[model samples]
Every structure is written in C-alpha cells, then in structure tokens.
Target: MTPVVSLRGVRVAHQGRTVVHAVDLDIQRGSWFGLVGANGSGKTSLLKALAGRLPFSGGACLIGGEDMIADRAGRAEQFGFAPPADRLPDSLRASEMLAFVGGHLDRVRRNLGPLRQALGVDPLLDQWIGNCSAGMKQRLAIAAAFAGGQKLVILDEPFNWLDPVAIFDLRLALRQMVDDGLTLITALHDLHALVVACDDGLILANGKKRIDLSHGMLRDAAVAPSLFEKEMIDILRAGAAE
Candidate 1:
C-alpha cells in the first residue's frame, strides 16, 4: 500500500536560516510514528511544515498521494494538529476553543463526546481556558485535536502535564484509534513512552535525521529502555559534533 504520508528532500528554514535539512520520510497508514529530538532540533518546524502551519522548501510533501505543499488547504483538511498548550486561546472556554480549532461546531461536538470522556476533559468544557491547569488545558487541546475527525492527527509533546492515569488512558485511546485506521504522529520527549507507544520513530539532532527507529528497533528498545536511551544520546552527540 502507498504510504499515507511521504516527504522527499524536504527542507525547512526560518528567517533565512535552514532548520530541517534534506529530510525524507514515509508514514504508513494507521501507524503511530514518533519524532524524537532535543531542543532546537527542528522537530517542531518539521511538524509545523507537515501540518501546513509553516512554509517549507525544496521538496514534495504528499498526503494520500496528493502533494500537500502545492495545495495545502485542500490536503490540510485531512489532518488535525495540536500545538503546545500555550498556543491555545486562553480567553475562551474549553468548549469554545475546541469548536474554533476543530471547525464545524456540530461535528466537533458530535466527535468530542467520546473523546472528552476518554481524555477526561468533560468537566473542563465549561471552564475558562485561562483558569484551567496545565494538565487540564493539555487534555482539552488533545480532545480538540481529535474532535475534527481527521484521518491523521499530529501532536506535539502530547503527554506533557498529563498525570500517570491520564497518560495511560490517552495511550490506550491512541492505540485503539490507530487500530481503527487513524494515522497518528507525535513529537515526543519521553523516550520510554516513545519506545512503548510508537511503531516507528525518527530521531533528529541539530535539525538533521540522526536515526530512524524501525519496528524491530522499537521492540528491542522496549526491552532495554536505558540502553536505547544511551544509544540515542550517543547518536545525537555524534550529530551535534559534526
């Protein structure tokens, strides 16, 4: 089967400075892919470019066989993205914010019922986003991202600020969604969770792809989390030195 998403020679720049450099990637349909990188490693930039929130150059970004870079608006409708919680509108209630970001209030509402319950954001819907705790805001943002009923969803550090139980619940929910044919991609800092939850992953260092972790690699990583983490650190260090 054709990959659900593909990137060829992809590059991203900010204010005339190159960030992501000549990256190529493919994400299979219904797979959970993880992006792992340290600070200023271009993970966010790549994710933003893929989500059509940032302009990129020098490549083709295809979603479901269509070039999304050439027709961002049309292809972007097929995916939903949740940036860091700080990007969320604090002035609105959680419900209003969801509707704004998710589009089609009725559809958002319809899809949010189960999502809100799964993410434990039901009680927070009426609360002002400004007043919600970081964890609460995170739950709301996640719920909003999923409420759009998109085939693909991209999340940035989604497990941040979530409690253990909440993290567990979200992981289970994501696994179920992927099994049900949703393609999930996330930028993650939690190495253990990345090893456990992701079917495949890419590691970046200084805006360059340092390592591509396959399914077998992730399975091995799951068995030796510390070893995997150390190896990743070594790879990142090598990249940084170069």
Candidate 2:
C-alpha cells in the first residue's frame, strides 16, 4: 500500500533562517503519529509543511500516492486541520462555525460524521465563539478538524488547557479514528500524553529528526510524570551545561 504521507528532503525556514533541516518522513495509512519537541523546535513548522499550510524548500509531499503541492485540492480533501492559523469568527456560535467549515471545504463535507455527544460546546453551543474558554474552543477546533469526511487530521498542541478527563477523552477519540482507518499527526507538549495517545511518535530536536518510536517503545519508556519531568529537566540542564 502507498504511504498516506511522505516527505523527502523537506526543509523549512522563517525570515530567511532555516528552522528545519533536510528531513524525510513516511507516515503509513491508518496510524497515529505524534510530533514532539520543545518550543521553537520546529514541530509546528513541520506540521505546517505536512499540512500544506506553508511553503518549504526542496521536498515532495505526497498524499495517498499523489503529489500534494501538485494536486492541491485533492490532497486538501484528504486532510483536516485544527487551530488552522486563522482564528474563529467571534460573532459565530459553535454550530455556525461547523457549518461554515463544512461549506468552505467543498468536497470534504460528505465525509463528516455526527458531532461528539459531549462536545465542548455542550454548555455553550448557543453562545458566541468569543465567550468560550480555551479548552472549550480547543475541543470545538478538534471537532471541526475531524469533521469526518477526511482520512487524515493535523492537530497542533491540541491538549492545551484541557483537564485530565478531557485529555483521556481526546486520546480515545484519536484511537477511534485509527480504528476506523484515519491517519493523524499531532503536535503535543506533554510527552506523557503523546506517549499515551499516539501509537508511534516522531521526535524532532535541533532542527533534525531523532528516534521514531513505536507504540511498544512508548509503553516500555515509563512515560509517566516523573520520567517526563526528568527528561525535560535534563534538556534544560544540558542546555545550561552547554
């Protein structure tokens, strides 16, 4: 089977400075892939490149056996994005935003399923977008991304501001997608959460790609609170020691 997503010699830059090196990644269909790194470590940049949200240098990004940049709409129809750079229109209700995205996406609406039963908008679906909490809005964002018709989803720091139970719910939700043959690439801060939610993860450091850990690796790493805290602290200490 053809890879769902592929990048070859992909490099990204901002204001004429390189942020990502010559990186190549192949994400198989129906797998959950995590993108993890420190702030400004180019996780977001790589996601933007993968999602076709930004331009980069020297690479071919493919979606389901086709070139992404060459067949823009076809590739676009295969993916959805949460927190998609543009902010929500403040005057719209949660439902209204959903309708708008469904309409704007052209051919993607046919793939959407029903919204979550306990949507973050449950208490405020009737309220304006401006009034919701960050967590609530983030949920709505994921809801919009998974709008269902697409086969792939790209989420950047989606767990921000969510409570513990909400985190678990999100994890289950992503797993459901994988079970149903959907592909995912999420950017996350909490290494533990990424280790928990993703079946495989891509670790980016120093504008380079490191280990691409599988689910078994995540399970064996003791990716609980203490190990996570220690790793982060070590990153800090190593920076200081340098």
Candidate 3:
C-alpha cells in the first residue's frame, strides 16, 4: 500500500536561511509518528511542508498518493492540520467551535459530547474558549482537528498548554485514531508522553533529521535520550550561529 505521506529531498528556507534541508520521509498509513527536537530544529517547518502549508525548494510530497506540488488544496483538505494559526473564534463556546468544524466539511455528526469527554473538555465545553485556560484552549484546538475526521492529522507542539492528565487523554485519543487507521504526526515536548504514544521516532536537529529509532531503543536507559539531547543542542547552537 502507498504510504499516507511521503517526502523526498525536501528543503525549506526563509529569508535566505535554509531551515530544513533535503528531508526524506514516509509516514505509513495508520501509524503514529513522533518528531522530537529543540527550538529551531526545523520541526514546525517540516510539518508545515508536509501539510502543504509551505513551499519547498526541491522535493516531492505525496499525500495519499496525490502530489502536493501538483494539487495542494485538494490534497491538504484530506488531512487535518491544526496549526497554531489562532484561527479560532475566541468568543465561541467549545460546542460552537466544534459546530464550525463540522460545518466546514458538511459533517452531520455534531455530537461532540463523546469527544469532549475523551479529550477531557466536557467541563469547559459551554464556556467561551477565550476565557478558558491555556490547557483548555489546547484541548479545543485538538478537538477541532479531530472533528473533521480527516485521514491524516498533523499537529505541531500540540502539548503546549495541556496539563498532565489532559495530555494523557490526548494520547489516548491519538492512539485510538492510529489504531482506527488515521495517520498521525505530532511534535510533543514531554518525553514520557512520547514514550507511551509513539512507536518509531524521528529526531530533528540543526534543520535536519539526525535519528530514527525503534521504540525499544527510544526507551533504552543509556541510548535514545542521550543521543536526542545531543542533537537538540546541535540544533540550538546552529540557531545561535544564525
């Protein structure tokens, strides 16, 4: 079967500075992939490129066998992209927010009750999202992303404002989605979350991917964490140089 997403020789630059260079990646259908990195490691850029939100220098990114360069919108709409775009209506209730998401794709399933509980947004669903806490906002964002029921979901720093329990619930929803055949790619900060949620790991640093490790290796006592930290520093220093 064709991969849910594929990228080869992908490069992204900004203001004459190369951010991501020659990245080749493949995300299998129904797999949950993790991206681990420090700031400026090109994690967000790479995710955006894969989501077809950024133009790349030289490469092909195929989404569900459709080339993004050739048909960007059609391909992009097939995947759920919850960018940190602040695109939500602040005054809307959580239920109203999900209603908007449902309306976007003409979905009749306005039953956000279950998902709200699953994502732990039940208590805050009727309140204005703008007045909610940061974790609540994060949960709302995630709810919208999954609301559309797209085949692929790409999330960047999705754990930014989430509390520990909310984070775990999000992990549960994500894992359930993968098991149900939706491709997932996420950038997260907590190591414990990553350990529980992902199988294979991709480590990015200095605008490039430095390591791809098995779940066992990532959980190793003297292996994955050490190497990942080193790569993260490399990325941080590289950013400082620039």
lDDT of 3 by residue, 77-121 (tens): 776777463656787887787777767423513333245576675
Q: Which candidate is the best by TM-score?
A: 1
TM-score of candidate 2 to 2 decimals: 0.84
TM-score computed on alpha carbons, candidate 1 = 0.94
Model 2 alpha-carbon miss at residue 167, Å? 1.2
Candidate 1 residues lying further than 4 Å off, grouped into runs, are 103-106, 112-114
Q: For candidate 1, lDDT tens digit of each residue in 122-227?
A: 6887899999888988888788778788889999899999899989888988888888888999999889989989999899988899878999999998889999
Which is the better candidate, 1 or 2, if ranked by lDDT?
1
RMSD of each: 1.6, 3.5, 3.4
Give each model a TM-score.
Answer: 0.94, 0.84, 0.82
Decide which is better by TM-score, 2 or 3. 2
The digit string of per-residue lDDT tens for model 2 on 25-47 reads: 87889988888777777889888
Error of 3 at 69 (Å): 2.7
Of candidates 3 and 1, the better by TM-score: 1
Q: Clash pairs of candidate 3?
A: none
